[model samples]
Target: MQSVERTFELLELMADSGGEVALSDLAEQSGLPLPTIHRIIRTLVNNGYARQQPSRRYALGPRLIRLGETASRALGSWARPYLAELTEITGESANMAVLDGEQIVYVAQAPSPHSMRMFTEVGRRVDAHATAVGKAVLATMPADEVAQLLARTPMSPKTENTITTIESMHEELERIRARGYSIDDGEQEVGVRCFAVAVPGAPAGAAISISGPEARMTRISTDEVIPLMQRLASSLSAELSASA
Candidate 1:
């Protein structure tokens, strides 16, 4: 059991180091002896869970892709009931998204009953800087890590309100942190507005959102919407933690 825990710890450390790490770096980061780290890494490499790069650093292997896709699908399935509840309560579209690599991917959604409503296809990927769900997840990350991620992806404008500069994005993130929620006011798309909150204690970066046309969305008070979203996010987080 201890060995199993150690192996998973190393894997998570490698993932946190942008998917690759040297043996020495792993040893330092994990506080495990060099020999133990080497042995565990060798086992992972043999089992196809990890690979040795040409540069001799270790990276997550292709086999994990299958596991990731399966888990993501299951996560979406488990989140549907909560999303439905949010949509029913808010009378708007509800969505759940996860941070995948440098992008945000919608995993599940529940549509509004109204004829005119917002819809984002499941599995659609978008830049993290442009959407409420994305910003909600980003607000949970360290400033330096957020900066690094933003630097890796071009912050192209999706609409006139899109935040195009890292400095301005940082300011927005700060506001989200202070308010405990994020807002996309015609940022991802003109005429759409959204409110999102991060799922507390989620294993990965995940968030839930409610969205609608700006005309209707603006009519919903933040005092009401933010608390509802936060409550639902917490309930969903608890469910996820238990299942995990």
Candidate 2:
């Protein structure tokens, strides 16, 4: 059990380091002894979970890609029913997205019944600073880390309402934290409004959202919509945790 935990710790630390690290750095970051780190890393290398790079740093092995892609597909598959239910209840498009590095990747979506509804296709990637689902999940991250992530992205405005500065993003995230949900307010698209809430206790940065035309997803309706999104997000969190 201890070895298993240590192995995961090393893997997580490697991931945080952008998929590669030196042995000494891993020891320092994980607070594990050099010998212990070496032993676990050796086993990982032997099994193709980690590899010694040409530069002598250890990198996450290519083999993990298959596992990650499979798990991502499974996660999307499991979350679709919940997204579909939310779409049915809210009469809007429902989406599930996860933070992948500095980008938010839409994984699953159920379209609204309205013919003129907003559509964010599955596998579409967008900057984290420009979307409600992005803000919802980023609001759950540490302030410094969020800043670092934003620094890496271009912060380009998708629409006039998109957040284009780190300071503004911080302010937006604070409001999202207080409200327990996020509003897009035509940020990602000129005429669309979006509402999102993080899936608590799921993966590091997972969120669910509903979107529609701004005229339909109005401020007056927000009072009702937010609660439904929050409740469904909570339900999803529980189901995901239980399945894990």
Candidate 3:
């Protein structure tokens, strides 16, 4: 196989194992020699395609987001137009995110004019238990994987409202899956609330959300947000599926 094919295969191998692989593990898994794997990994690392943690394990790095953004920008032009529409209609900050480990990384955002809403940069990451988009996407993963992630990361409360127990977070994900949405009831911050919908995609878990002052967001229940978000999620899913 060609070097590019090997590189792409390496990416897939790492991604499927949840983005953390040891050198020995990668060599074993990829059927490549250790020195060859080291060279490929070093090349991938230098090019921003992978990261080697202090423990000497490798994981998907910032390059994945670069690739995701490129795909999102190209595939989500229609979604962008609608995001502005949603913000206009709801008067809340609208955003999109995807799961990266146990965190939700915002990939796009359309904020409302409200002076006191959540402010998120394009690449901001937050604990899944503390935000709407995080819960929405986490609902789609296998129970064992979720357990493993939560096991490694303690449920530290971002605010008094954050879920601080694994059992509770699991329950929250269950609700997200069954109800087809998720809510952040002042979880990440003291006075902010958000509602999110899952946007199913391969190798990445994306979600769309609306967040703002709790007083205002609570004025509209999850029921009110569902139709618009479901519509958006459906469109996003279709876009990703077609691209795949």
**TM-score of every candidate:** 0.88, 0.88, 0.79
Question: Per-residue CA lDDT of candidate 1, range 182-241, in tens?
Answer: 999999999999999999887679999999999999899889878888888899899898
CA lDDT, every model vs. true structure: 0.92, 0.88, 0.80
**What number of clashing residue pairs does each candidate have, in the order they appear?**
0, 0, 0
Which residue runs does candidate 3 get wrong by more than 4 Å?
1-6, 12-20, 27-78
- Which is better, 1 or 3, measured by TM-score? 1
TM-score of 1: 0.88
**Displacement of the residue 217 alpha carbon in candidate 1, Å:** 1.6
Candidate 1: which stretches are off by over 4 Å? Answer: none
The positional error of residue 2 in candidate 2, measured at the CA in angstroms, is 1.5
Q: Which ten residues in a row have the lowest lDDT in candidate 3?
A: 71-80
